[model samples]
Target: MARPVTNAAFEALLHAAGYGNAHAAFARQLNHAGRNYGTWRYDAASVYWWLRGRRPAEHVQATMAETLARKLGRSVAVLELGFGAGEGTGTSIYPASAGQAIDAAERLWTTLAKHIRPPVSGTFDSGKALQAALGWRYDLPDKTVSRNGRQPVTTGDIQSLYALADHFTDLDRRHGGGSPHTRALMADFLVRQVALMLRGNYTDVVGRDLLRAAATLSGQLAFMSYDAGDHATAQHHTTVALRLAKAADDRLHGAHLLANLAAQAVHLGHARDAARLAEAAIDGAGRAPAAVLARLYTTAATAYGQSGERRACQVALAKAERALDRTGLSVGPRWVNYFGPAHLAGAALRCLGDLHLYTQALRHAPDAITLSSQNARTRALHTALIATIHARAGDTDAACDWGRKLARHAVGVHSARVEQRVRELTAMLSPQQALPQVSEVLYALSTVPAAT
Candidate 1:
């Protein structure tokens, strides 16, 4: 076989960036910048391979580009370093200017509108997510968001957008985000309507409100994509939302977006990243409403639990509980109204279950189920959690019973996250498939179609 072709462009960029023959120093900078993602012990030998045309991982490529940008004191696209285009490194998570941020958002929205499915790499950039969180907390808000465009944006227009967001959010909560039709409709709205509004003329005050409304809709789309198991799309939308929130000077909304990213990190098994993101959200949530604080705390608890920090998890859960108690007669943001008693109980159950504290987890299961009666998706997820808990405890009968309940509750739900839980429960029961109940549940699970 012929030898791999050397990446001349990468070498040229490295030389231009002053690395030239100092592969060791380049590797050191890459490793240091990579700490946000995880430990990277790359040395000269590792950089040598890249010089010989060995491509780095996507996240590593991003890190390398960022490192070069810092050294050169200029923006550097990943493709400029010989990496493939459209790999999510073209746009920075924290753009240097508001114009760049808008340009990034426009590009992402346009790409998403075209329904471009990114290659499924099954990779989560915890480092990028963490960076976005840090930027949101420390970066200065835009001085003014006033814009002049062809058509003028009005208060009525902003109100209409908020109403539409509420409608889409309700659809997502009820029917789940796995529906192709629902996803298409949301994308259509974002492109055909929201995009136009963003470019329309508006004053500073109106522009701030418009950005907030757009951020809310974008965040909902992010969660929906996440539920559909399209993590790349989710992250893209989340970045846009965070940018909008920052431009609007909405710190609480920014905190909510960070919490959502933390939840995604936890789902993707980056427990440490999840914990850091959640902690960032909590720290930046200054004077937030009680409901919002509770939501952030619960996210931290789940992340800590996943990391096996039992004491930290418990502390977060207790803080969540106290925040909820303080939410007694006050109405928080509509986006956070979902984090009431039922949601908190479900989070506690999942956190305890992550620690293998089945007995403690079970105690919260009833409240999770009963209180989430109207939320089919949450109920289905909690059902699967209960079944898994029993399966882990070696109670085949109890597990199978809850498994059947999960099947029932999952009938109309279209959530990839819930379906994943169902698959896990089935796997646990597969070992006991010799039993009639386990076999029956397994058969029931077989009929459940993959969430779209």
Candidate 2:
């Protein structure tokens, strides 16, 4: 008999989950995850199977992975655990060849639209994403546009996809992520319409454009999910978007997504993760437009500020300012169209606010107010920020003034992030809620749930 080496992986996972013994605990987890193999004993009998190098059934692999995922608070892919080919309806292959990448994307799209059980991919690790972004910039696989599909694709189809992405971006900007009706429509359009066109035959040039468009749309959905306060779902889609960018050899697009993911990480209090992601974006940008560079630096500044690194944060913010000055409102990419001085000013407001530079925050805050005027969704955030700044400065009246504005602007908005910020502001101004406007606004904000 081969002497048993310690099953470090399984044992460590079990220990990390606070399980004392593997035999009974593994069985319990299986039962808890509703995985039963028709009288296949899960106790001691199956405990050594994994250690003995036996491949588990596909469904069992999924159940065990998911059970561990719930405990770890991250999506876990069964394949990563050395399980045999999983039975997941969706493919999670981040493809090496363009044709394979397209096929993989279709598989994921169909399965996600169907809402199959067991997630297709693992949680988004900043390290992995950073590597992927760098890989895209340096070493993307050679491409081929297969002309074997039944339907033929054209430049018009690519343009239509771009327009569709733009439409969703506009909708998200106008309505925030809380517009379930619109978000649902966008999701369906992506799977039913976008995926269909993506699968059709097209020339290499047209195919690259189509994939880039799809990446942008996926990133849009990720941002929407972030706005709605669904971080996990946001991460899930963002990973796919990054893969699409790689597939299209779109380094700038990948960089953009890296920044977006960084911002989300910052909001979620993963300051170090946010910083790394921002750095990845900057590194992969490859002489991108000034606006894109500025936006990336601003994101980095926010991360460093959140991490309590004042000097680092200041440096990043200055870099952003320099990039913005170099551009001087020169039009940038359509995706980064919002990264002007005013937008950077808004980002500076957030960064300074995080650093407790209340005065500085107040100074930059007004520049962003114009953006709020153009985008109510952004207004919700600005109002919340300005209100907090005033409250922190002991200006209760001014805070309440902005609070009322927030409440007014938030009437039709459904964003969890904006509402969360409002709630934080409300808590800060709780002592002053006796004022008529404060009372009214407090009552209005009462309906926003703490959850997304």
lDDT of 1 by residue, 29-70 (tens): 999886644357999888778877777765466668788989
What is candidate 1's CA lDDT for residue 313?
99
After superposing candidate 2, which stretches have Cα over 4 Å from the reference? 1-104, 111-131, 134-139, 145-147, 328-331, 372-374, 434-437, 447-452
Clash list (residue pairs), candidate 1: none
Candidate lDDT values, in order:
0.82, 0.72
TM-scores for the candidates = 0.79, 0.75
Best candidate, lDDT: 1
Off by over 4 Å in 1: 1-92, 118-122, 372-374
